[model samples]
Target: MRDVKACRVCRSPLPRAGRGRPPAYCSRACQAKAYRRRKNPPVPTPAASRRPGRRRQIAEALWRIAAERGLDAASMREIAAEARVSLRVVQYHFDGKHELLLAALAMLNADNERRARARMATVDVDDPRELLRAILDEFLPVDEQRLLALRVFAAYFARSLVDPELAAVFLHDGQPLEELVATVLTDFGGIPDPRREADLLVSGITGLGMDVVHGRRTLAEVRATIAYHLDRLGGTGKVPGAEAPGTAVV
Candidate 1:
């Protein structure tokens, strides 16, 4: 039996008669109108066909390839293959591997910053404990996605160390976190040399992240280690050791 349906052309609530042909239009006139409309469908603009957008699609392809196979494998041909686009298309968007990697780095950094900002949006910067916690949380790879991002960082940073041009860009991007660490230390660490302490803390946290990523240590261990160091810095409020906040640097 034909099921109940609306007329395709007029949508006039036409019901199906028992054991009859399905109506494409409400009436003969509606059917003629529908045929005319079909023959003159509006043509979509070029921008409309660029739905997801080419630049984003290329970035996504490169990011996915780098994440899965490491940056070394994210070549122009490989990225083009991954995105199901031609090599010339990929090259049209990005000049070469370095430029592609830089774009990826920028995207990854922006994503991380966006997430961290959202997470710390309501954090009390004046509160020493809260500030320190937020700062540390931003650095920690608490989830698998974050750990994957770290791999991207590792790839670029390693390359940057040897290439001064890349190093300049990398260092500039890294300064914000370093400054944040310094601020937290100055306000909470209770140590005289907050700048030095900040550097040390950053170094320590970086190592802890490495261990966690390499599976040598767990997230629990990382937290424990951080807490231990923070306590030494007297982050709870007052300095704990025999050192004064100004005179004796703990």
Candidate 2:
């Protein structure tokens, strides 16, 4: 005698259809409902998801504090209050301000890198000047989010002045970018000293961002400056009316 099977959903006795296979559910409707329940369960989200959300809240609080006030103002207690979590919660995710600073920096850098990658995807990598323009645009504070992020960056730089560990993190963050840009300059600009050019361009782009943040220049003027600099570098003269190698367009 064959064993009787019950429906997975309604627990009703199941009648097998033909000799091919045993029925897991009594009816198609029951099977679909069961599958739907399995797919979209009513249970609360797992703790893993909630934990990251809490961590993000704390990090965002830290970012805001760093940007609005200073990193010094991002003490654990203040972060707890800002994040609306317990001080222990903040301490649980991050041992101290250094760890919190690193977390916030990771978030900030991730955002910047995401934007940079997206922009680079659409740009012409074969054209070095355009590539540099795409890369440096990510460095600029063209809009509100970038502006706030740059403010947070300013706060972090000031804090890193005295903290060697923070300085190390800053260097770690920048070294890869320098290497990448140097490689690009080597390929596109026919520059002999790619590293030197990369360093200069990185610093120059940073200064341009700072200038924009400080009201020293408009974003269009910044783009024009970048174009002028890249034009001097002279990748390929594909675009019409491109500036000459020695000329500064603006």
Q: Which candidate comes out best when scored by lDDT?
A: 2
Compute the lDDT of residue 204 as modeled in candidate 1: 78
Report clash pairs, candidate 2: none
Cand. 2 Cα-lDDT: 0.78
**Model 2 — which ten-residue stretch has the worst lDDT?**
237-246
Report, for every candidate in turn, its global Cα lDDT versus the true structure: 0.72, 0.78
Deviation in Å, model 1, residue 157 alpha carbon:
1.8
Residue-pair clashes per prediction, in order, are 0, 0
Q: lDDT score, residue 27, model 1?
A: 85
Residue lDDT tens for model 1, 150-173: 766777667777789778777785
Listed in order, each prediction's TM-score against the native is 0.68, 0.69
> Per-residue lDDT of 1-250 in model 2, one digit per residue for the tens?
4544777655676665567666787889998987887787755732232367778888889888888998888888998999998876776576577777887799888877887778789998887666777787878897788888999999999988999998998766548778888888887745667788788888889998999988999999988877776765655423336555323332
